[model samples]
Target: MPKKRRRISAFFKILTVLTVACGVLVAGGYYVIRSVQRVELTPPPPPSGCTLTAAGDTDELEVEQAANAATISGVAFGRDLPPHAVVVAFATVWQESKFRNIEFGDRDSVGLFQQRPSQEWGDPEQLMDPVYSSGEFYDGLVEIAGYEEMPVYEAAQAVQRSADGFAYDQHERRSRTMAAAFTGAEGPAVTCWYDTDEAGEADVEAAQAEMDRVFGTDGALPAAESRTGDPGWAMAAWAVANAERYGLTSVEYGGQRWSAAEGIDGWTEAPGEGGGAAAEDQVVLR
Candidate 1:
């Protein structure tokens, strides 16, 4: 009976060892498999706002400038102005304020275009407004004979009448980049990453009102109810240009999405509602 008991006890000990060994093998196999598998991590998008370069290079302020430049050029295009006008406007602004709407400048030079109130550009208050300053610049530009045929810097200098005529030349390349991206001449050219966390909900109403304030009540924007196509893209691009000030989170068009949180250097495929590149489309923000 004692021998029989000993045998049973030994058998139980073997069973226990086997159970622990199996557990160790199972755990080891799991670790090996996990280590061998490749885990792909999606890179985080850029900071919110806009990035103009292909390399995802740009700051919030510069992105704001790009967006404002888009609005300026967009308004010109809406008025049936030639493409050179947009380019010239961009270069001029780049030279003047680096696209900032400053309240101060060299001897009272103020606003995005650096239009001096002393020069009769407008009141100090009017010059602070980007739309008003852009209009003033265009007003002077269109008056120059054969301005359309002139070079971009020359055209800008003519309108600006700057002390140094060659200064505008420095901004020509960046101006062209911005003009092309915002004009929709280049597809998926402009991408902006902004702060969606603090931005809260998209403000379509404020965006529309600001659009009207800048582009005017003309047919520049689609009806509040809907938008699509090139016009839709144009409007959406405008929203992208102003995304920083407006708390706009994303602007979708042409089967692509530009999100502030995505920090994507450029537009990426967004194949869903309001994401199609149709003639009538929506500009999503928030």
Candidate 2:
């Protein structure tokens, strides 16, 4: 009887140990599964956008808007116009079309500045072209006497002749920030990011042609080594702005590099001397 009782007790002890072991294993597995679930539930970062920072303020822009803004600023730079001119143009475009190259607006208005064909701004197709429209805006802006010294809204009004001329005032601060960034008054101020799968294959020829058209410098992009200062940074910012359109992977200038893969982080110090074989004065595009 004593032996039998001892055997029974040993069986109960074994059973308790086994039960406790199984419970511990089950608890550990549940914890691991919950941890994996938490990791999987984390959302990915949003893609496809650009930002310009200047004077301690950051402004966000849709990728298309950024490209158009860069074109406008590029035209000004090509003309050797002051940054104030870019500010005026930005204000006008913001009020007119929010920097979008749209086909429709109030009273047959169209394109970036909402220039109407009936009013002889241009044919619809020509007005729809960003480079052409930007050039047209700058052409009119420069003709306004004392426009450089005028308030942003006043200068924009002189060029746009909008019904509510004062409306351009609302965008003055934002315009200044954009002008400063795109004009390279602030180095590496423009940063853009997008998905690589969506960027498509880069078209070097197309990018070169567009740069020539906007900057009016034929064969200049290939000779980026000759460029420097604000002009160099401006060209670098232009490449960044149009990266999505041209499928550009990277742009480097002034010892800093901006890559599409790490674009949101802005410009980082280059690994080698002036972006490796590219001169410090150059805006190297890849």
Candidate 3:
């Protein structure tokens, strides 16, 4: 009888140990998931029957594409964020750094959102990642007390805390128009560029070539001024918004080994370096 009781006690002890071990494992798994989140930036699907062709012009298509991409990404996580939200974010990006994830900053800012690595947004790579930066922006938006309920620009300002807070107002309208087109739930770089110089001119050519190969088109996208709601500006803004990620500066893309010869308007105005203001205005989606 004594031996049997001892055996039973040992079994209970073993069970308790196993239970504790499982609890630890489960907690560890949850922590890992929260830390390394897998965020997909895919845009929304087109409404029943819509295509890029319906945009009538590239400018319109650009707006549409931005709207689509932003809206899709906003909505994808089951968040139901408005298209205007994305517009606000895109416009802010344009003004912030011409949408280029620059290595430069106020004292030493870097990445698309001009985030400071010291702030804990992430290490260098996280700041440079559009998806992560954008995700952080979106997360802040959702956390606001009445962000979605307020005017989009106001809501965005609440999250961005920009030096030029009031300026974000104008961008709200433009973002919606562009978001509509890119709504197919795409994660395709709503922005991109092939830096010929920083990337060794050939790399630029190769990137451009890849775009042409898959997209089947020339280097020149229809200018947004004439395209009207096409995804051009949105796409350009994305490229500008995330330019630093590709290792480019305004002067670099302006000419040099790359090809800013046209004196563009989407990311940077015809003006010199600090053109974040004009660039912000250019990609307004609405």
Among these predictions, the greatest TM-score belongs to: 2
Q: What is the lDDT of residue 53 in candidate 2?
A: 94
| TM-score, structure 1 vs. true | 0.72
Q: Per-residue lDDT for 236 in model 3?
A: 41
- Report RMSD (Å) for each prediction in the order shown: 8.6, 4.9, 23.0
Between the candidate structures 2 and 3, which one is better when assessed by TM-score?
2
Model 1 per-residue lDDT tens digits across residues 1-286: 6999999999999999999999999999999899878677788644545665422333234566766776786567545566678789988887888877788889989888888888999999998887888888888998999998998889888888899978888877766666666666555666665656666566767887777665555434533332111345556677776776677766676567776656556577776554355423555554
Model 2: which ten-residue window has the lowest total lDDT? 220-229
Candidate 2 residues 1-286, lDDT tens each? Answer: 6999999999999999999999999999999998988784656757799988997899999999999998888887667788898889899999888998999999899999899999888999999998888889889988999987899999999888889999999999999888888888788899999888877998867886787788777745432332212777777888898998899998888788999899989998877853555737677778
Between which residue pairs do clashes occur in model 2? none
Model 1: residues >4 Å from true position, as ranges? 1-49, 53-61, 217-231, 273-286
Count of residue pairs whose backbone atoms collide, per candidate: 19, 0, 59
Local distance difference test, each candidate: 0.70, 0.85, 0.47
Error of 3 at 70 (Å): 6.7
Would you estimate the TM-scores of all the predictions? Answer: 0.72, 0.84, 0.42
Flag the better candidate by TM-score, 1 or 2.
2
Residue 189 in model 1: lDDT = 63
